[model samples]
Target: MNTIEPRSTPQPHLTLAQADHQDTLRNCVRRSLNEYFRNLEGEAPNDLYPMVLAEMEIPLLEKVLEYTRGNQTKAAEMLGLNRGTLRKKLKQYGLL
Candidate 1:
Protein backbone atom coordinates (compact mmCIF):
# COMPACT_ATOMS: atom_id res chain seq x y z
CA MET A 1 0.00 0.00 0.00
CA ASN A 2 1.15 3.55 -0.79
CA THR A 3 0.73 6.27 1.83
CA ILE A 4 0.85 10.03 1.42
CA GLU A 5 3.01 12.13 3.73
CA PRO A 6 1.45 14.98 5.65
CA ARG A 7 2.40 18.44 4.45
CA SER A 8 3.39 21.17 6.88
CA THR A 9 1.56 24.45 6.96
CA PRO A 10 3.42 27.40 5.53
CA GLN A 11 4.30 30.32 7.81
CA PRO A 12 3.56 33.92 6.79
CA HIS A 13 6.32 36.25 7.85
CA LEU A 14 7.47 39.64 6.56
CA THR A 15 10.63 41.03 8.12
CA LEU A 16 11.31 44.78 8.20
CA ALA A 17 14.13 44.42 5.67
CA GLN A 18 11.88 42.40 3.35
CA ALA A 19 9.13 44.96 3.68
CA ASP A 20 11.58 47.78 2.86
CA HIS A 21 12.80 45.86 -0.19
CA GLN A 22 9.19 45.42 -1.38
CA ASP A 23 8.51 49.15 -0.93
CA THR A 24 11.62 49.99 -2.93
CA LEU A 25 10.56 47.64 -5.71
CA ARG A 26 7.07 49.16 -5.79
CA ASN A 27 8.49 52.70 -6.05
CA CYS A 28 10.86 51.65 -8.85
CA VAL A 29 8.02 50.15 -10.86
CA ARG A 30 5.87 53.26 -10.36
CA ARG A 31 8.74 55.49 -11.51
CA SER A 32 9.40 53.35 -14.57
CA LEU A 33 5.74 53.35 -15.65
CA ASN A 34 5.48 57.09 -15.13
CA GLU A 35 8.54 57.70 -17.29
CA TYR A 36 7.19 55.40 -20.01
CA PHE A 37 3.86 57.24 -20.06
CA ARG A 38 5.62 60.59 -20.25
CA ASN A 39 7.68 59.46 -23.24
CA LEU A 40 4.57 58.11 -24.97
CA GLU A 41 2.74 61.38 -24.48
CA GLY A 42 5.68 63.34 -25.90
CA GLU A 43 5.76 61.17 -29.04
CA ALA A 44 2.01 61.20 -29.62
CA PRO A 45 0.37 64.25 -31.23
CA ASN A 46 -2.98 63.99 -29.45
CA ASP A 47 -3.92 63.37 -25.80
CA LEU A 48 -3.58 59.60 -25.46
CA TYR A 49 -4.75 58.81 -21.94
CA PRO A 50 -8.39 57.94 -22.68
CA MET A 51 -7.53 56.27 -26.00
CA VAL A 52 -4.85 54.16 -24.38
CA LEU A 53 -7.06 53.13 -21.45
CA ALA A 54 -9.99 52.21 -23.73
CA GLU A 55 -7.76 50.17 -26.06
CA MET A 56 -6.19 48.32 -23.14
CA GLU A 57 -9.47 47.74 -21.28
CA ILE A 58 -11.30 46.31 -24.30
CA PRO A 59 -8.94 43.36 -24.97
CA LEU A 60 -8.43 42.78 -21.25
CA LEU A 61 -12.16 42.58 -20.56
CA GLU A 62 -12.74 40.36 -23.59
CA LYS A 63 -9.97 37.98 -22.52
CA VAL A 64 -11.26 37.85 -18.96
CA LEU A 65 -14.80 37.14 -20.14
CA GLU A 66 -13.49 34.46 -22.51
CA TYR A 67 -11.49 32.90 -19.69
CA THR A 68 -14.72 32.69 -17.72
CA ARG A 69 -16.38 31.19 -20.79
CA GLY A 70 -18.56 34.28 -21.37
CA ASN A 71 -20.08 34.12 -17.91
CA GLN A 72 -20.41 37.63 -16.50
CA THR A 73 -20.83 36.49 -12.88
CA LYS A 74 -17.55 34.57 -12.82
CA ALA A 75 -15.77 37.33 -14.76
CA ALA A 76 -17.03 39.95 -12.32
CA GLU A 77 -15.84 37.85 -9.39
CA MET A 78 -12.41 37.48 -10.96
CA LEU A 79 -12.33 41.23 -11.60
CA GLY A 80 -13.41 42.05 -8.00
CA LEU A 81 -16.46 43.96 -9.26
CA ASN A 82 -20.22 43.62 -9.04
CA ARG A 83 -22.14 41.95 -11.85
CA GLY A 84 -24.02 45.19 -12.60
CA THR A 85 -20.80 47.17 -12.93
CA LEU A 86 -19.29 44.59 -15.24
CA ARG A 87 -22.42 44.59 -17.38
CA LYS A 88 -22.34 48.36 -17.57
CA LYS A 89 -18.72 48.37 -18.69
CA LEU A 90 -19.38 45.67 -21.25
CA LYS A 91 -22.29 47.64 -22.67
CA GLN A 92 -20.30 50.87 -22.67
CA TYR A 93 -17.52 49.18 -24.62
CA GLY A 94 -20.09 47.55 -26.97
CA LEU A 95 -18.87 44.10 -25.96
CA LEU A 96 -22.25 43.02 -24.65
Candidate 2:
Protein backbone atom coordinates (compact mmCIF):
# COMPACT_ATOMS: atom_id res chain seq x y z
CA MET A 1 0.00 0.00 0.00
CA ASN A 2 1.26 3.44 -0.96
CA THR A 3 0.80 6.38 1.46
CA ILE A 4 -0.43 9.62 -0.04
CA GLU A 5 1.52 12.82 0.64
CA PRO A 6 -0.25 16.06 1.39
CA ARG A 7 0.18 18.76 -1.23
CA SER A 8 1.48 22.17 -0.30
CA THR A 9 -0.81 25.16 -0.70
CA PRO A 10 -0.33 27.17 -3.88
CA GLN A 11 1.19 30.61 -3.61
CA PRO A 12 -1.13 33.57 -3.97
CA HIS A 13 -1.16 35.20 -7.38
CA LEU A 14 -0.17 38.84 -7.72
CA THR A 15 -1.92 41.22 -10.09
CA LEU A 16 -0.01 43.43 -12.53
CA ALA A 17 -0.11 46.35 -10.15
CA GLN A 18 1.15 44.22 -7.29
CA ALA A 19 4.02 42.90 -9.40
CA ASP A 20 4.97 46.41 -10.50
CA HIS A 21 4.84 47.63 -6.92
CA GLN A 22 7.20 44.82 -5.85
CA ASP A 23 9.61 45.64 -8.67
CA THR A 24 9.56 49.31 -7.77
CA LEU A 25 10.28 48.52 -4.13
CA ARG A 26 13.15 46.23 -5.14
CA ASN A 27 14.69 48.93 -7.35
CA CYS A 28 14.37 51.51 -4.61
CA VAL A 29 16.12 49.24 -2.10
CA ARG A 30 18.88 48.36 -4.55
CA ARG A 31 19.55 52.00 -5.36
CA SER A 32 19.51 52.97 -1.67
CA LEU A 33 21.94 50.17 -0.74
CA ASN A 34 24.33 51.12 -3.54
CA GLU A 35 24.28 54.74 -2.40
CA TYR A 36 24.72 53.74 1.22
CA PHE A 37 27.77 51.58 0.48
CA ARG A 38 29.32 54.31 -1.63
CA ASN A 39 28.91 56.78 1.23
CA LEU A 40 30.41 54.34 3.78
CA GLU A 41 33.84 55.82 2.95
CA GLY A 42 35.79 52.62 3.90
CA GLU A 43 34.04 52.25 7.23
CA ALA A 44 32.63 48.82 8.11
CA PRO A 45 28.84 48.59 8.31
CA ASN A 46 27.12 47.86 11.61
CA ASP A 47 23.61 46.67 12.49
CA LEU A 48 22.60 46.85 8.84
CA TYR A 49 19.75 44.38 9.13
CA PRO A 50 17.96 46.22 11.91
CA MET A 51 18.70 49.56 10.32
CA VAL A 52 17.09 48.55 7.04
CA LEU A 53 14.10 46.99 8.77
CA ALA A 54 13.52 50.07 10.92
CA GLU A 55 13.79 52.37 7.93
CA MET A 56 11.34 50.31 5.88
CA GLU A 57 8.99 49.46 8.72
CA ILE A 58 8.36 53.09 9.71
CA PRO A 59 7.07 54.17 6.31
CA LEU A 60 5.23 50.89 5.80
CA LEU A 61 3.36 51.13 9.09
CA GLU A 62 2.64 54.81 8.54
CA LYS A 63 1.18 54.25 5.08
CA VAL A 64 -0.85 51.26 6.19
CA LEU A 65 -2.21 53.14 9.17
CA GLU A 66 -3.05 56.11 6.98
CA TYR A 67 -4.73 53.84 4.45
CA THR A 68 -6.73 52.21 7.19
CA ARG A 69 -7.62 55.57 8.70
CA GLY A 70 -6.01 54.84 12.07
CA ASN A 71 -7.84 51.53 12.45
CA GLN A 72 -5.36 49.24 14.18
CA THR A 73 -7.18 46.05 13.31
CA LYS A 74 -7.32 46.76 9.60
CA ALA A 75 -3.79 48.12 9.53
CA ALA A 76 -2.46 45.05 11.32
CA GLU A 77 -4.36 42.76 9.01
CA MET A 78 -2.97 44.53 5.97
CA LEU A 79 0.55 44.39 7.41
CA GLY A 80 0.23 40.72 8.52
CA LEU A 81 1.04 41.81 12.08
CA ASN A 82 -0.91 41.22 15.29
CA ARG A 83 -2.91 44.23 16.48
CA GLY A 84 -0.97 44.28 19.75
CA THR A 85 2.32 44.18 17.84
CA LEU A 86 1.17 47.07 15.68
CA ARG A 87 0.29 49.12 18.72
CA LYS A 88 3.68 48.36 20.27
CA LYS A 89 5.43 49.46 17.09
CA LEU A 90 3.36 52.62 16.93
CA LYS A 91 4.35 53.46 20.49
CA GLN A 92 7.98 52.61 19.79
CA TYR A 93 8.03 54.93 16.78
CA GLY A 94 6.19 57.68 18.66
CA LEU A 95 3.38 57.48 16.13
CA LEU A 96 0.84 56.62 18.78
Candidate 3:
Protein backbone atom coordinates (compact mmCIF):
# COMPACT_ATOMS: atom_id res chain seq x y z
CA MET A 1 0.00 0.00 0.00
CA ASN A 2 1.21 3.50 -0.78
CA THR A 3 0.77 6.27 1.78
CA ILE A 4 0.90 9.99 1.35
CA GLU A 5 2.57 12.27 3.89
CA PRO A 6 1.35 15.71 4.80
CA ARG A 7 3.55 18.59 3.74
CA SER A 8 4.97 21.21 6.02
CA THR A 9 4.72 24.93 5.30
CA PRO A 10 7.74 26.39 3.60
CA GLN A 11 9.72 29.09 5.38
CA PRO A 12 11.49 32.01 3.77
CA HIS A 13 15.30 31.91 4.04
CA LEU A 14 16.09 35.59 4.13
CA THR A 15 19.35 36.60 5.78
CA LEU A 16 19.85 39.55 8.14
CA ALA A 17 21.65 41.43 5.39
CA GLN A 18 18.78 40.81 3.00
CA ALA A 19 16.28 42.07 5.58
CA ASP A 20 18.40 45.19 6.09
CA HIS A 21 18.60 45.70 2.37
CA GLN A 22 14.81 45.44 2.12
CA ASP A 23 14.44 48.05 4.82
CA THR A 24 16.93 50.27 3.03
CA LEU A 25 14.95 49.98 -0.17
CA ARG A 26 11.77 51.00 1.62
CA ASN A 27 13.55 53.96 3.20
CA CYS A 28 14.88 55.02 -0.17
CA VAL A 29 11.38 55.09 -1.62
CA ARG A 30 10.13 57.00 1.39
CA ARG A 31 12.90 59.56 1.05
CA SER A 32 12.30 59.94 -2.67
CA LEU A 33 8.58 60.51 -2.14
CA ASN A 34 9.28 63.04 0.56
CA GLU A 35 11.59 64.89 -1.80
CA TYR A 36 9.00 64.77 -4.55
CA PHE A 37 6.33 66.18 -2.29
CA ARG A 38 8.69 68.92 -1.18
CA ASN A 39 9.48 69.81 -4.76
CA LEU A 40 5.79 70.02 -5.67
CA GLU A 41 5.79 73.39 -3.84
CA GLY A 42 2.05 73.42 -3.09
CA GLU A 43 1.02 71.99 -6.45
CA ALA A 44 -1.19 68.94 -6.40
CA PRO A 45 0.30 65.60 -7.37
CA ASN A 46 -1.11 63.89 -10.48
CA ASP A 47 -0.95 60.30 -11.69
CA LEU A 48 1.53 59.39 -8.96
CA TYR A 49 0.59 55.74 -8.97
CA PRO A 50 1.36 55.07 -12.62
CA MET A 51 4.38 57.36 -12.47
CA VAL A 52 5.98 55.44 -9.63
CA LEU A 53 5.04 52.06 -11.09
CA ALA A 54 6.59 52.91 -14.46
CA GLU A 55 9.72 54.32 -12.85
CA MET A 56 10.15 51.20 -10.72
CA GLU A 57 9.04 48.64 -13.30
CA ILE A 58 11.45 49.70 -16.03
CA PRO A 59 14.62 49.28 -14.00
CA LEU A 60 13.29 46.14 -12.33
CA LEU A 61 12.59 44.46 -15.66
CA GLU A 62 15.83 45.65 -17.18
CA LYS A 63 17.98 44.39 -14.32
CA VAL A 64 16.15 41.08 -14.02
CA LEU A 65 16.45 40.49 -17.76
CA GLU A 66 20.12 41.38 -17.59
CA TYR A 67 20.60 39.08 -14.63
CA THR A 68 18.91 36.22 -16.45
CA ARG A 69 20.86 37.02 -19.61
CA GLY A 70 17.63 37.99 -21.39
CA ASN A 71 15.80 34.78 -20.49
CA GLN A 72 12.12 35.75 -20.08
CA THR A 73 11.06 32.38 -18.60
CA LYS A 74 13.64 32.46 -15.82
CA ALA A 75 13.00 36.13 -15.19
CA ALA A 76 9.25 35.52 -14.91
CA GLU A 77 9.82 32.63 -12.52
CA MET A 78 12.10 34.75 -10.37
CA LEU A 79 9.56 37.57 -10.35
CA GLY A 80 6.62 35.25 -9.55
CA LEU A 81 4.98 36.49 -12.74
CA ASN A 82 3.51 34.63 -15.67
CA ARG A 83 5.78 34.55 -18.73
CA GLY A 84 3.08 36.20 -20.83
CA THR A 85 2.54 38.87 -18.20
CA LEU A 86 6.28 39.54 -18.16
CA ARG A 87 6.27 39.83 -21.93
CA LYS A 88 3.36 42.25 -21.75
CA LYS A 89 5.24 44.37 -19.24
CA LEU A 90 8.38 44.22 -21.38
CA LYS A 91 6.42 45.41 -24.37
CA GLN A 92 4.58 48.06 -22.37
CA TYR A 93 7.92 49.42 -21.21
CA GLY A 94 9.37 49.36 -24.73
CA LEU A 95 11.98 46.81 -23.65
CA LEU A 96 10.74 44.13 -26.06
Candidate 4:
Protein backbone atom coordinates (compact mmCIF):
# COMPACT_ATOMS: atom_id res chain seq x y z
CA MET A 1 0.00 0.00 0.00
CA ASN A 2 1.13 3.56 -0.74
CA THR A 3 1.05 6.13 2.03
CA ILE A 4 1.20 9.93 1.99
CA GLU A 5 3.06 11.97 4.58
CA PRO A 6 1.95 15.34 5.94
CA ARG A 7 4.12 18.26 4.86
CA SER A 8 5.73 20.55 7.37
CA THR A 9 5.19 24.28 7.24
CA PRO A 10 8.12 26.48 6.32
CA GLN A 11 9.56 28.88 8.86
CA PRO A 12 10.64 32.23 7.47
CA HIS A 13 13.69 33.90 8.96
CA LEU A 14 15.47 37.15 8.18
CA THR A 15 19.16 37.57 8.93
CA LEU A 16 20.81 40.86 9.84
CA ALA A 17 22.69 40.86 6.54
CA GLN A 18 19.46 40.42 4.63
CA ALA A 19 17.91 43.35 6.51
CA ASP A 20 20.94 45.49 5.73
CA HIS A 21 20.73 44.54 2.08
CA GLN A 22 17.07 45.58 1.99
CA ASP A 23 17.98 48.94 3.53
CA THR A 24 20.74 49.38 0.97
CA LEU A 25 18.32 48.74 -1.87
CA ARG A 26 15.86 51.23 -0.46
CA ASN A 27 18.57 53.85 -0.12
CA CYS A 28 19.74 53.33 -3.68
CA VAL A 29 16.20 53.78 -5.02
CA ARG A 30 15.75 56.93 -2.96
CA ARG A 31 19.03 58.36 -4.24
CA SER A 32 18.19 57.54 -7.84
CA LEU A 33 14.77 59.18 -7.58
CA ASN A 34 16.32 62.30 -6.08
CA GLU A 35 18.82 62.52 -8.88
CA TYR A 36 16.13 62.03 -11.50
CA PHE A 37 14.03 64.90 -10.19
CA ARG A 38 17.09 67.07 -9.72
CA ASN A 39 18.06 66.54 -13.32
CA LEU A 40 14.59 67.59 -14.46
CA GLU A 41 15.34 71.13 -13.24
CA GLY A 42 11.77 72.46 -13.50
CA GLU A 43 10.87 70.31 -16.48
CA ALA A 44 8.07 67.85 -15.95
CA PRO A 45 8.88 64.17 -16.17
CA ASN A 46 6.68 62.08 -18.44
CA ASP A 47 5.85 58.37 -18.29
CA LEU A 48 8.04 57.78 -15.26
CA TYR A 49 6.54 54.36 -14.53
CA PRO A 50 7.01 52.90 -18.01
CA MET A 51 10.42 54.55 -18.33
CA VAL A 52 11.71 53.11 -15.09
CA LEU A 53 10.13 49.69 -15.68
CA ALA A 54 11.67 49.38 -19.14
CA GLU A 55 15.07 50.52 -17.93
CA MET A 56 15.09 48.09 -15.02
CA GLU A 57 13.40 45.26 -16.90
CA ILE A 58 15.84 45.03 -19.80
CA PRO A 59 18.93 44.55 -17.70
CA LEU A 60 17.09 42.22 -15.30
CA LEU A 61 15.86 40.02 -18.13
CA GLU A 62 19.33 39.95 -19.66
CA LYS A 63 20.98 38.90 -16.40
CA VAL A 64 18.36 36.28 -15.58
CA LEU A 65 18.56 34.81 -19.06
CA GLU A 66 22.32 34.69 -18.81
CA TYR A 67 22.18 33.17 -15.36
CA THR A 68 19.83 30.44 -16.54
CA ARG A 69 21.94 29.92 -19.66
CA GLY A 70 18.83 30.48 -21.78
CA ASN A 71 16.79 27.93 -19.85
CA GLN A 72 13.35 29.50 -19.89
CA THR A 73 11.92 27.21 -17.22
CA LYS A 74 14.58 27.94 -14.61
CA ALA A 75 14.76 31.60 -15.50
CA ALA A 76 11.01 31.98 -15.15
CA GLU A 77 11.10 30.26 -11.78
CA MET A 78 13.91 32.49 -10.51
CA LEU A 79 12.15 35.61 -11.77
CA GLY A 80 8.78 34.55 -10.25
CA LEU A 81 7.29 35.01 -13.68
CA ASN A 82 5.05 32.54 -15.41
CA ARG A 83 6.67 30.75 -18.34
CA GLY A 84 4.43 32.60 -20.79
CA THR A 85 5.19 35.97 -19.21
CA LEU A 86 8.91 35.25 -19.23
CA ARG A 87 8.72 34.19 -22.85
CA LYS A 88 6.82 37.36 -23.72
CA LYS A 89 9.38 39.54 -22.00
CA LEU A 90 12.22 37.68 -23.67
CA LYS A 91 10.56 38.22 -27.02
CA GLN A 92 9.78 41.84 -26.23
CA TYR A 93 13.40 42.49 -25.32
CA GLY A 94 14.49 40.62 -28.46
CA LEU A 95 16.43 38.08 -26.39
CA LEU A 96 14.40 35.17 -27.81
Task: Write candidate 4's Cα lDDT for 1-96 as tens digits.
Answer: 999876987757878766645657566666678899999989999999988888778888999989989898999999999999999988887878
lDDT of each: 0.81, 0.90, 0.91, 0.85
Q: Write the per-residue lDDT of candidate 3 for residues 1-96, one digit (tens) a residue.
A: 999886987869988766655657676787788899999999999999999999888999999999999999999999999999999999998999
What tens digits encode model 2's per-residue C-alpha lDDT throughout 1-96?
A: 999986987868988766655657886897799899999999999999999999999999999989999999999999898999999999998999
lDDT of 1 at 90: 98
After the best TM-score superposition of candidate 1, give how far the Cα of residue 33 lies from its true spot, in angstroms. 11
Candidate 3 overall lDDT versus native: 0.91
Report how far off residue 78 is in candidate 4 (Å).
0.7
Which candidate model has the greater TM-score, 3 or 4?
3
Question: Candidate 4 clashing pairs?
Answer: none
Ranking by TM-score, best first? 3, 2, 4, 1
Alpha carbon RMSD to native, model 2: 8.8
Give the TM-score of each candidate: 0.53, 0.74, 0.75, 0.68
